[model samples]
Target: MSYWRWLWLALKMIYQLLCCSVSLILFCFNVFWLFCNLAIPWCTLTLLIVCIASKFVKLQRSPNEKRLLSLLSTPEDRPSYWAIANRAAGFDAPENSKAAIKKCLARGYRNVLLDAGLTSCGEIVLANPKRMNVAQQSLDELQKLNITEYHPMGSQYEPESMASLRQFAEFLDAEADQATVFLRLHDTSARMLDQLQKFMTTDEAFTQRTVVISRSPLAIYQLRKLKPEIICGLWHETFLSLAILKSSTLVTSIYGAILRNIIAPVIGISVVFLSKEEINLHIADLWRNVGVRPIVYMVNSPNEKRYFQKTMKIQYLTDSLRSEPHLLMKA
Candidate 1:
């Protein structure tokens, strides 16, 4: 199954590259025709210089990157994991619920990844904004609703309420001493940052152990600017999804690579969550050379887990702990 999946992905990538090459040829021809017709030699020469200059322009390290480098010098600060429980082991309980987190901890997983979004009252909750209108409802109103109703295994577990980011932090402080939490932010608004800043200020441990990740480069940049010491991560996959929708996969892949390699470093991200399809030794090494940890997501196969863990020596996010019970024993 894995081999077939890889083959399919390779074929898709080849087709995309062919399409992109054709588009680039047409675009270049059109631009050349315009340049010849208008006869603007100076404008063309100036544009060429700017493009060439951009290649050699060195990017200065941000304050956050410097701080991250220092922190990474310590062996204890380096992230090592068997797997991160995606959505707090959602298969065991409702995703982003307190029950899911408790179950994940009980299963001996040390790394947990949760989605975060803001409520109507400016409170951060562990929920996906895209799935529901989390921003339109107050925290109180959201908590009253049964989060498990829409879940496939809702009847198997007791009714669960939406878990707040504060509650997750407090739970970590009390129950899980060695655990690390990764918060994937769905709402990257100023209000959400303010709340996160407040939490990080009050809890020193949380600030050190928690990694805040976002798909938006601007959001990550703003976060680093606001709190240079806080651990931040950039999430990739949105651009690839958009590329598929727009039928411009190769062009988008090039843009995504630039964003991941160039823009993410400039934003001072400490970690990067890449889609499973994007996992490759070259890209992983690229991130490692620059002091950024690369993690793959939605990995569920046990064989793939062993490859990523033993061979790649990288962490991954998995949806179900039940699928890999033996790995939990090693963790």
Candidate 2:
């Protein structure tokens, strides 16, 4: 049978089991209450809790099953798959900021994207948190790597300041002709738009090669007007819920469709989902439907590393720690 068919059968079986079991329990309780033949004591509550816990145990995913799933639910590898790639490919900052980026460069990673945000601690120290450069040591490491493009990380879209906009424009101007700089806007503000417009019209870098991570349909419409080099879809955050999973024919379908149908083709854009587990069948199917690539994120474990490598079918694998000079030398 087709994959969809199997998915449908599985969903139906789960629904039936849930309904039948609940109905049987309710019927037994009602029958006993109606007869009033026995005294109900604390034992009854204890029994109910035990039965419910036992049911939950049966419903839990087994260890081997989880491992198998980790293997089978592989993500695709493609330029469009950067959402997952970024998390996997992130640098371990505390010990060495440049290590991960340098490793990516050595591994021939040309298209580089990063999550640029200030942590609570960073906010207290830096005046412009997002604009801070990599550590000198890290920058030195990056100097050794080949980088063609960089995308600024973001989620909200806020009005921009002319000064910040100019700073960004200048940063773009300083880069090579082939190099592109993309911004991820999280807040939707006219001031931000004004800044974007200034950068797009006046700045040679913005006019020639710049991209933005846009979420609002309205912002996308405005961005397309700029005639940017590329407009890709960006999923800033994803939180999974039971409602989303069961609502679909396949567990992955609901989310996949939102990104594909609702986010991509409409804007002539590509998309990135933040979490691997969150990129369910819904999102993958959506990618298949729209012919758009899907990406997953934030994978740090060794087991996850093996699973993504062997099963995720991801195009690019991003990981923390570019390289420990020691580890690389040892290798």
Candidate 3:
């Protein structure tokens, strides 16, 4: 099943890459939008915040990576699958809306994720604020991630309401007694991140309940400098690749030629949905050697959830927990 899905993802990515340029061009174009978005507001930030010095940040100091692989070595590593509600429980409501996220939490998913998009003005809104007269795929120049809901062909597009970062923070404070929220940073501006950081520091609950996932090296690095205790994961999306080759640490790992200690440290990763094919001990050992756990996405099927719960024994970042309501308590 994973093979077929990954194959389809490969084809879709190929189509997108050919239709749009994705390499460094993707990052460069986002920087262009960053400036445009920043310029939307009169001022960048309302408050002045001091950032910690880079030199003072704690670097990954474990002498060997084996010690950190402790999570992967034991059956007790995770008793219940630690699932992350991908995009706030998938089309249950518009992605990242309060309604959908609440549904996931009510269904017993303890972790939820949302894409954090910073607006041109100083506000941090959810990733997909609906735009007027916009063709969905073309919204991003490079079409990376392409997280959007498909409407009927020729259907008029209009956004009613989307959650703001502040609104999400408030919701998390209220709803997180039963769960945690993971914000995947989409915009890396210091001012934008400051909005998130300030909200996080409001009380002990904020920092304790919130986790961050980011692709930007500088941003995550800076996050470490600021809050060493926060759990941060490195997120990677390839509309393709096998587990051994496409991870964020691939270049540093050199196909396992180099020691994992030399690779950049990340607590976890977002990857394709794992199936029975991924249960090989040899393959698990290779990943264990690296010390990073896979946060599998696309666990929307009840059978798959049951399989993962019984066999995979790891974290799953899914969009269909509420859709498969019966699987929630049993799995």
Candidate 4:
């Protein structure tokens, strides 16, 4: 056989191997999603499965696929918070449970947030082995910092009923001065948007003393139309600890979002909110700007918190950690 022919055959074999490896990886991810659904619904299942099977269909790559791949390969210096959340906390509610809250507080972070609906049976069983009202238990720890949890907007799949909101409202009404409510919006439809508007509008207290997470642009626009007292600007991406070291631009934007959307709404409007991450690579590096507080996370261990704080020079740290000084001991 000619030398050129042999080289061509070797290259073809390598290409086939690469393709097979990629296929196997996608297939395994599909199976893992199915397994996860055995416990909780993984909504992306159908889309993911279809994509996997369609690999055999050999359809020409659509523009959407090209765009998605481009986005995926955009060389994100910082990993997604969702990915880190899963890795650190097993995609379970334990990460947000009561013990986790206490641990996080002990780490010296004055402000924190939680997803109220994300609860763990372990927390219910262990924290209050007596099965105390877990909600109240959460409220107790939340009192320490400005905490907000979002109830998904659409179906009952992740829904917090109006009754739950009412209960939360009551909690806020009592501590209107000390604590503020952060409202999270889900992938909502037009009808859902209208209903949410009605709910917030009917109650002046709810509208005035609330921070919102508007997932969609329409949701943000609609909520503003209702003239809710405080509409948290959309935070499409949550700040992750890794992001601080990777891209200062990304971190600065997140800091600005928290200030404008999260902090300012809760504190007051006098606060000037700018795209901190977008403005420059570093707040100090670019201009002498103050009043910027950054959000950073610590997932694996308490010691990681100190490492992140020193490495990123983060002013704040969010973690599902217990208050143990030894936990944050030098990494």
Cα lDDT, all candidates: 0.75, 0.43, 0.54, 0.38
Question: Candidate 4: which pairs clash?
Answer: 103-321, 103-322, 104-321, 252-276, 252-277, 253-277
CA error at residue 8 for candidate 2, angstroms: 54
lDDT (tens digit, per residue) of candidate 2 on 65-95 = 3332232232343122221224214333211
lDDT of 1 by residue, 1-331 (tens): 9999999999999999999999999999999999887767776677567545644542333445554444333234323346788888877678877677777767656677889989899888889666789999999998898988867888987987787878877877787755667889988888888888888878887887778888887887777676776788888764555546458766665565566556766677778888878768887887788767888988898888878877887778898877663645567
Compared with the true structure, what per-residue lDDT tens digits does model 4 show for residues 1-331? 6999999999999999999999999999999888886644554565456445544532221213333223222133322211112111212224333323232223332122323221222111112222224333443343343211221212222322222344555644653332223344432455545555676777777655454544354555455545534444343343334556356766556555444444333322211212223322364332223222333333344454454445543322233333223333433
The segments of candidate 2 whose C-alpha lies over 4 angstroms from its true place after superposition are 1-108, 114-182, 204-209, 215-217, 226-229, 242-259, 280-282, 302-306, 315-330
Candidate numbers, best lDDT first, in rank order: 1, 3, 2, 4
Candidate whose TM-score is highest:
1
As a whole number from 0 to 100, the lDDT of residue 198 in candidate 4 is 70
Error of model 1, residue 126, in angstroms = 1.4
Worst 10 residues of 3 by lDDT: 46-55
- Cα miss at 276, model 3 (Å)? 10
RMSD of 1: 13.3
Candidate 3 lDDT over residue span 1-331, tens digit each: 9999999999999998876665668889899898778854523242111112222433553323343233223233223335667777755655766666666656655567877776555666666434321212232331233223342211232333555666666777776555566778877778766776766667556666556777665676676555554556655444225654555565434533322222234322212123333334454455556555555566677676766566766566676565453555566
Q: What is the lDDT of residue 148 in candidate 4?
A: 17
Q: Top model by lDDT, which number?
A: 1
Where does model 3 exceed 4 Å of error?
Answer: 1-82, 129-160, 239-260, 266-291, 322-331
Query: When superposed on Cα atoms, how far off is each prediction in RMSD?
Result: 13.3, 20.3, 19.3, 19.0
